[model samples]
Target: MQINRLFEMVYLLLNKKSITARELAERFEVSTRTIYRDLDILSSAGIPIYTSQGKGGGISLMDNFILNKSVFSEEEKNEILYALQSLSIAQSPESEKVLAKLNGFFDHKRSNWIEADLTPWGSGKDSQSSFSKLKEAILNRRVICFEYFNAMGESRGRTVEPLKLTFKVYAWYLQGYCRTRNAYRTFKIARMSDIVLTEEHFEEREIQGGLTMEDDETSLLSLRLNVTADSAFRVFDDFSETDIQRMDDGSFSISVKLPESNWLIGYLLSYGDSMTVMEPKHIRERLREQAEQIAARYQ
Candidate 1:
């Protein structure tokens, strides 16, 4: 925790361009003496920190001076390492480089905290290869071709412009423009049929500040899915939490901005009897036909 606070001080000083010991102590809830002590530590560690006694000057890092990773405490090293390891999987070169730079800061014991190999998704099905190619596409700002299996067990080949990588609800997804559907779409790597990193390039998009998707042609489809209480959480966690409206009898009315594709059909089917199509009579009808066919198979 002390190291974290120290790193916070350095980050703020470098960010603010200038601040007084009084400000640092106040912001960090420490005594002015402690602030001065921190400055001394930075200065000794070659952070180029110094004090000025004149009007409006207190403490500052030199304009060109930089943090030497060698001076980072074990805890600071641990944080940096963890961040870098995550980037490596998300395909962030900057994060991976930070992980490499983190190497300069940590001793052997601290290096253990930066394990990039372990993943929350488990090791079996969607491990290294899936994330590896995704990171590659993101780093290069390129579109990639991948085979995707729709809900009907149909596999389609398509290309997508990888836009941003996201971590939510304990999974990783690539949100991008789906070329075939001509819409913005989010694809989960775990469900990806096969991926082939293409030579085609794409201009990178800015990190959208929040979950709001701009109403655009790429974000075109909207649908209503009627789901029981047990199945609602997955939908809530997938789409905007605000998008879900509750019905009177404890069922759910789920609305989502979906790309135009057969993918929607498969998604609804994944819920099986736990959900039903309410709007877009076409989807509801289609589900009915499929159910009848499946029943006929049993008969």
Candidate 2:
């Protein structure tokens, strides 16, 4: 931890030019004595850290000192830039600023080591706008209200304490405390409309284990699907190589784990006659009934 603190102290000096011992202590949540000791450690390590004890004086790095590229190995620097660039994909202005600052620190030109555009094709403009608003609300601890449409096609107004914006499976979701439901809910950004950010701030609540930012890997249902050759392109696009197998008839069999929900049913239906549920009689029956209903309507 001390080693991390020392690195942070150097970064702070590099960014802020100078800071008071009291300020450093408060920033790191350590005592002035501890700050002084860390300064001694930096100075001994030839970091060019110096402190002046007078009015308008504070701890500062030498004006000529530039961070050596060796401090961050080339791979490590690339990783940091890659992370910032990924954040920028969400259209985050702050991420762009920090990314530029970090590049400047290393005296490196912008490198296209990685590019991440998480939005699906034809889905960027709206998703980026929603992500920006949700990110702002989360950072400012503001309450947000939006009209949410559920899978059942019901629309309702929701007031939530925006907690986190997550990018999962090529879509953005807002996980927050829903005042209407009296529980934490994950609202898909695509289904949200009429976004309103309230000026009222909210104190952070202790998050439940199930409702944290991490994705739930449990509760997965194993599904078997038979895909016709006509839809094999769609199959390859959606499924990983390991989850699919080619049959002698030129069809494809896909066995995958997915969260069992209405969304799963809808996703299967979207594939139409080109795909069939090979197992799980209940799911197959449900799909068959839905198809029969549609046929009856046409008849």
Highest TM-score: give the candidate number. 2
Expressed as tens digits, the lDDT of each residue in 7-103 for candidate 2 is: 6788889888679999989988999999999988889899998888888899998999997778888889888888888776667665676778778
Among these predictions, the greatest lDDT belongs to: 2
Q: Please report, as a residue range, the 10-residue window in candidate 2 with the lowest summed lDDT.
A: 210-219
Candidate 1: TM-score? 0.48
How many residue pairs clash in all the candidates, one count each? Answer: 3, 0
User: Which 10 residues in a row give candidate 1 its minimum summed lDDT?
Assistant: 210-219
Instruction: Write candidate 1's Cα lDDT for 179-255 as tens digits.
Output: 78866777665567578888889887764544333222233567887788887667776767787888898888888
Work out candidate 2's RMSD over C-alphas: 6.5
Report the lDDT of model 1 for residue 217.
Answer: 29
Error of 1 at 168 (Å): 6.6
Candidate 2 to truth, TM: 0.64
